[model samples]
Target: MPVTTDLVQQVLRLANEVNAFAKQCGRADLSQTLVEVAARWKETETTIVVAGAQKRGKSRLINALVGRPGLLPVDADVATNCHLTLRRGPVLSATVHRNDGDVEIDPEQIADYASTTGDPAKRRDVLGVDVTMDHPLLDGVRLLDTPGVDSLTLGHRQATVAILQRADALLFALSAQDQPVLRHELEFLAEAMERVQAVAFVLTKVEDSANAQALLEENRRRLATFVADAGRSSPGTAAALAPLLEAPWLPVSAKLAEAAAAQRSLGREDRAAKLQERSGMGPLEDYIRACAGGRELTRSATVVSACVSVLSSLTAVAEDDVASASEDGAEAARRLAEVDKALEELTRTMRDRRRHAVGNQFLGREVSAIVRARLARVRQPYEQAISELGTRAALERYLAQLPESVEQSIRAAWDDIVAEVSRLVGRALNEFLAALGLEPMEMDLAKLSMPTVWSHELQSEPGESAKLDLLREGVPAATMAVTIGMALAHLNPIGFLIGPAIAAAVMSRRREWEQVHRNQAALRRLVSEQFTQAAGEITLALEREVASWRVAVEETADIALAGQRKELEARRAELRAPAGRSAADRGQARRRAADRLARAGELTERALALRGEIGPAVNALA
Candidate 1:
């Protein structure tokens, strides 16, 4: 009974392992195309997924195999934004089944999927799209048109993931182009390796290279290496996937396949069909055969192996920690503890590794670069503001001295100017004094400032050139007539008494007043002339000075930058946190876990030893 139970358990285990590993590998979908497969094994409809990047001719290859020109709408409807499902049976026209209802979206309206607005009756939006046609492969297979994992932004990754989760057989399109396995692709591969069965690789878009056959081998070699590193190597697993990591990479041309399809439909072997004839169909057929159906036998073996690995790790960890004593219950308890520790360690390691690969390497560094560039411009706005302020200051000095220069050149005919201006002032001053209606005594007419003096002071004021006349009219007119008289009295018989008297005084001292006015006028004129010359010269000097100041500021700023360089260095130092966990430490941890498992397996007399070591803990199960 124990032997029979073990046999049944082993068979079930193999199935689970094979299925899980196949799923993980196919889920990556760096290559291959998926179409709606018509075959079904009860609850799960057999959906074949072709996962690969663009330029792999996934569409063309699929079209060639199906023997149809637009079976999956490869030329126009194959957009990289969404997942496509191809189905078969009857000759169904291209219909995009929306959530509301099915719509016949003509090939011309393919853009309607991502379009903002259009005929809702004829277009499917957002929800999902189904394009089906009558084709040979439609009878037993559903092809999934997976957008190139490489070409997707966030929006498309969602769509690709949704299609892959429940895929049946995966035709992995491995382009000679997808070498070194993009970190993202590897990630998806790692996960896929745990979930599906029947994984096949199709190397596409290889028109020419240094040895297509050798390249294929090299590509397969790396695939094997990836499996080895990820702890997925199983002696019992089939060679269908094993050879991939070691074979000469196959060459495929989508264009050639497309030409074949187009020519086969057109009857006679046309010139374009010659190119298709040159393409060897052997490799293509071989890959299809490898991935066409589910591998129940292989999947069964993998499940057993995986379960054993987990169990062995649990048994070893518990037994190893014992005091080298063959205690009955002691060995079991120790193994369980070790298993728990190993699981915890493995989980932590996986989580941390994922964070570094996706969060740090994939996105964190790019984000950091953007932030760093923005900070580099932090000083720009302040520098511009300071430069503008200096320019304004220079402008102010130039305008303050403008008026005086204009008055200086006009200082020639002073005397005649004075006499005429005095008479006008004298008459006005006489009227102002009489308006007070007081008795007028002999005023100091000789000392009274003349219109000539007033005119000079008015012109002397800074920025007052336009208003010079107001001072000239207001002050002189109020004063001169009060000091100089007779001219006013004799001229007007109807003059008021005080006005006449004041006019007489101005006439009497008109000579003395004129002399006094000349001196004041001389001083005012000199002041105006000097300020005028100063204003002009200073404005010109400011232009030159501002230029010099700007240079000095720049130089000083450079010096200041040298001092601040220390702080920048400190900031950069923070970025030097170790990029990845130490591989050596991880290797040692794994070896230690393996040793413990070997001891447990020897005691239990199991054929194989499996170790599942999580971070800081080791485990084995027997």
Candidate 2:
């Protein structure tokens, strides 16, 4: 069954009941763990860290994503000097957290506290700005805008790196205008892949570059080479990092998006939508949504895992009772001892997996490597041609065909990876549950699809016909006749003036229409140019629909998206946050333990039933 919030909520309800029963029976350890798990579940968020080289439109992209232009500081002279966190809240608010304390500030004054040119004393003390606004997109997601990672400033780089360590995902921005992906970018990406779980590369300022597609191809090749070489040092980590090579590398125009936003506010819905479509923000938004969904799945799975742990504890206690009371008590005691050992080992394994998120990371790297190898095999000929030919035109043609050539391979790889990951993770998790005497659980992981490849080529179009229509439509025949008649009235000065005035008015209206049409025509060409490249992939019949292909890839591949670490660690940390449990008298504890033994079997049965439901719910989400 498809994952639903209600399913997770039901699991939580069962968990809460288990917690209450444990508390009533004075099992403080289990009850405390349950409380912490529930708290972590409630606080779960997908933290996406936006990082990039300077002047790559990272800030603008965030602004566009949230539909709040200029919300974050974006001045070239005073770029984002510190990290800035954006999340949802009841109303728009901004606060600067520092060692001293958090200081509330107006949203407009964010630059004053967060940018390089901000008040020196305030900037030095500022940790980062915590911005909360009523944006629907920010729901259950936290956006962290970091200083350019390529900054020469030690503090800027360090701050960005620190944020990267905690990020659930990374949105690494690059510019299409900036060609030949730099060594520093590859270095940062290598470091970032080690730190963050999931990453999606964005090619910003596509509108500014005529060869955005070529640039994207070049960047992908360079990044792949870097990742491949990096993988050679540590094959496991490299294999885990492989899937990221196929992660969405979208080309977008922040300039067009901001203009679209302006037009939308001015009630130019048609124009706004056209510009927005051309901006390539729609696919980017969809990718972000997919990330959020993947995170929700991770959080849900973590909660269910916690429930299973509690159930295991209860069952063990029930087994202890059986050993104490039954005739075959010695055998029961031996089995219980074995169960205890398994539980201890399983707990440690789960903790280690959660701490490092290594399982999924390794799986992701392997999946990525598979995709890269397949694509490389297909592109080998083209690579050879480029090496042999070594001509600008030949290289450009090769770049144009690069994404299209690999499109089929990517889709196939996506399907294969999804099935493989589900199979592998399911087997591992079942083995884990089996040790605690639980039934095997079905794993229905979310199947993430490859992103659509978009390429645009703009060509100039004549607007003379449009300009003529503008004049004809703006000035009616009746008005033109009256003006001419008045001008002919004995060469009347006022009549002559009126004619020129009417002509000037018509010309002005013509200019406005011309400008509008020019923009519309440009947008149309941009879109047309994109499909011209995609024609080979899409059938002629399918090409009739303009907006249809836009939705082809609804989800981004989140194979590398982090595991249960965030929630599990939060559970562990919160469980440890409070002081240790107060000690009770030995006699009192023995008596209580004996008293609870009578009802332990009944509690265990209830927990076993709950565990059955919890596994499926977790699997559905995972």
Which model scores highest in lDDT?
Answer: 2
lDDT of every predicted structure (CA atoms)? 0.42, 0.60
Off by over 4 Å in 1: 1-40, 43-45, 68-82, 97-102, 114-127, 151-162, 177-180, 208-211, 232-250, 262-267, 270-274, 281-622
What clash count goes with each model?
97, 6
Candidate 2 lDDT, 1-622, residue by residue in tens = 4457776676667667778868785579878866765665545677778888767788888898888889887763233346899999999999988878988999999888888667776677677899999888888889998887652333456678767645666888989876456666676776665444456788999987999999888888987887788778866346545646666677888889999999999999999999999999988877666667776444444454455456556655543443434343354455545655655655665545343333333443444444445444544454344445333343345445544554554455445545665566556544544443333444433312234644423222323334345356555644774666586656765675567566667666656655545544444444434433333333222222111211111110111112233433333342232223233333344345455654554544544454444334322321
Worst lDDT run of 10 residues, candidate 1, spans 613-622
List all candidate RMSDs to the true structure.
Answer: 30.5, 23.8
Tell me the deviation in Å of residue 241 in model 2: 2.2
Question: Residue 396 of candidate 1: its Cα lDDT?
Answer: 35
